[model samples]
Target: MPTARIYQRPKNAMQSGKARTDRWQLEYEPAEPQRPDPLTGWAGSGDTRGQIRLGFPTMEAAVAYAEREGVAYTVVPAPTKTLKLQSYADNFK
Candidate 1:
């Protein structure tokens, strides 16, 4: 006599690491790095265009700042500012 065996799908698949990874990819896989806006956040000269600052959030924003400010931006400034505005409104006073 011969016996046959059957395989069942895993019930735990949904909670598995692969499933988590898949969910992450499906929900919010990160985008390619972009030039970030420096002014939008708490950094730089309230200039939307700024060089790639490690802390501001993105590189695109930095470059835009350079272009807008007419800075020598063959390269991005490393988040360096001399007497950089503590806040954008500081200049208004």
Candidate 2:
């Protein structure tokens, strides 16, 4: 039988060949430096060193702020966003 053409050769023939593609990638994603957060995997213990505290009349208020800020901060990927945003005002009684 006549030898098969190079392109039609079976893969088991042990021939080395290069591939060509008509398709091309459009946009290339930017390369970013990925590093784990230093404070990640933190175990919430009773340690307040170098940390800020929230002061509210009721424990519920503090808890609510904590939960809201935590969720919003993560949901929004803006450098200007922060969970420590505070509102303070004094009203004369």
TM-score per model over all chains: 0.22, 0.22
- Candidate 2, residues 1-93, lDDT tens digits: the string is 111111111122355442321111111122333445568954344323214422344334434554555422111111242366555653333
Q: Where does model 2 exceed 4 Å of error?
A: 1-49, 71-93
Alpha carbon deviation, residue 92, candidate 1 (Å): 64
lDDT of 2: 0.30
lDDT of 1: 0.33
CA deviation > 4 Å runs, candidate 1: 1-55, 76-93
Q: Candidate 1: lDDT of 2?
A: 15
Q: Score residue 66 of candidate 2 by CA lDDT.
A: 47
lDDT of 2 at 9: 13
